[model samples]
Target: MDTITLWELVALAGAATLVGFSKTAVSGANTVSLAIFAAVLPARESTGILLPLLIVGDMFAVRAYRRHADWATLVRLFPAVAAGVVAGTVFMLWADDAAVRTSIGVILLVMASITVWRRRTAGQQAREQKGQGEEEGRGEPAGEGRQRARLKAGSYGVLGGFTTMVANAGGPVMSMYLLSAGFRKLGFLGTSAWFFLIVNVAKVPFSVGLGLIDRHSLLLDAGLALCVVPGAFLGRAVVDRINQRLFERLVIAATVVGGLQLLLR
Candidate 1:
């Protein structure tokens, strides 16, 4: 940890700032931060170093968008997420985690495809409803809609927990979930902020037991956390200007990029 050069620190500071930007703006964009950190430090050590920085970013995100959170969504996810976290802990006991990472990457790509299909289907349904007129058209059955939501919450929640625990890659997974559920920008950001802040903080004990977080990592985090503040402000300043369509496109694009990186790495 002590051997990082001046240029390396510069790189880390920049990455740290992007951590905050990602938390507030486009959630999946922090895969860039993940890549930067991996390049600068040992991959394993980088995960530990980056976790605290992410928490700092999460704090700022929650403060800015806390009121917009969807509590019902959070409630639906926690149980499944907890189970996945435990599974991830066992995965860490394995000698190699390559298979798990590959599986997550593949799942991410599949989820992205599903989200696209769902959006198109919904748009088509909306158009058909408009053409059919209000009296003839009907909404989705409440029971069916509830069932689908539960299924999605379970699957995405487990995947989100496992990927986050294993690789700090949960953001893209959860972002896809939020987008699929038709959450608007502030709601997406707010729910995500609270979700990750809680999950990441919860992972601390496991990370410590795994020897991934320690005094040295915290020391590095202290310096890097400062960079996140500026990025948070930058994201907040520009978020309102981003129309919903563009925001969703950027989230999906980042999710795909993150998935490809994980798959190809």
Candidate 2:
């Protein structure tokens, strides 16, 4: 581990606050924290150190919105996500830090694109089906809706697992999916809070095996975790005021920008 200078500590504090804010309020912005961590620490070590800080933020989130989770959706996605975690572990074992960072960037960009395209196409399909149904004197069809849900769950699950393992960047990917699925307000926050808490907790063994978490990293995580408290409180206050559609669009845009930087850097 490198010696932490005063300036780097300040940066880490700022970044940690942003991370807590992003985790509970606006998620896509956590890229700021990711970049700061990578800048201040070695890439491999950064992920390990950041994980505990993230879990601290997650604790705040879970406390704020624990009552509104959708267990069924989480259960449906669990198996595929587990598969993704295994795949991510394999990739991390073999790939160098640069490769892992670049891969995560590319994955984030691709996932963002898929989410945008999916939203547009789904809207068009829904509109077209609605028109057709009016001509047939029927109500909105259930089959089309089911097909959309299935496609969304599968795509989101794969991307979420990959980005999370590689960069701890699953927030935006899952946020996009939950937003599209029409989870409103507290439900979105609650569901996302629990989902990430579980997934991140499950990742501990893999991170430990990869040597990402170490004694020094744990020390850093402790200092960073303190900054999460203020940010998390502010996030809880503002979460209900957020407009779901607009927040999601901003998240997608931020994810693309961050992903591109990671890839190109």
Candidate 3:
């Protein structure tokens, strides 16, 4: 680990706060924290150091939104997520830091594009449905919806698991998945909180075995964890002030910028 400077400490503290805020309030905004951590520490080491703080944030989130979680969605995602975690672990064992960074960046950018495109198409479909005076499921086949939902679960679950295992960058991918599934504000936050808390806790053993988490890393986390308290509180306090569309746009924009930074760096 590199020696932490004053500015780096400040940056890390800010990043930790963002982790908490993203957990409770903005779902995908923690890509900024990932970027900041990568900038301040070695790429792999940064992921290790960030994990504990994220867990702390996750706890806050789970507490705030535990009631609103969609267990059905979680059940659908877990098996595929496990597969992705195994794949990511294999990749991590072989890949260098640069490869990890570049791959995560590309994935983020691509996912963002896909998300934007999906939203546009969904909007068009909504307009057509409105024109026909049809309710959401009036004409669509139930089987088709079920199939699409399953496909979404598998695809996003795998991607989310892999990205999170490799780069702590799964938030945006999962956010995109949840948004496309028509989650409302509380449902989105609650479901996301539980998902990350469970997934991140599961990653601890992997991280330790990979030599990513240690006493030193935990010490660093201890300091930064304090920052998360205020951030989580603020997020809970003000989350209702922000609407869904604005939140989604902000998440998308941040994900894009974070990806570009990683790619260019």
The lDDT leader among the candidates is 3
Q: Kindly list the per-residue Cα lDDT of model 3 for residues 129-173, writing each as its tens digit.
A: 454432221233224578887988899999899989988888868
Give the alpha-carbon lDDT of every model: 0.76, 0.76, 0.81
Which predicted model would earn the best TM-score? Answer: 3
Q: Which residue pairs does candidate 3 place in steric collision?
A: none
The weakest ten consecutive residues by lDDT in model 1 span 133-142
lDDT measured at residue 111 in model 2 versus the true structure, 0 to 100: 65
- lDDT of the structure predicted as candidate 1: 0.76
Q: Which sections of candidate 3 miss by over 4 Å? A: 118-145, 243-254
Name the lDDT of candidate 2. 0.76
Better of 1 and 2 by TM-score: 2
Error of 2 at 197 (Å): 0.4
Clash totals for all candidate models: 0, 0, 0
Worst 10 residues of 2 by lDDT: 132-141
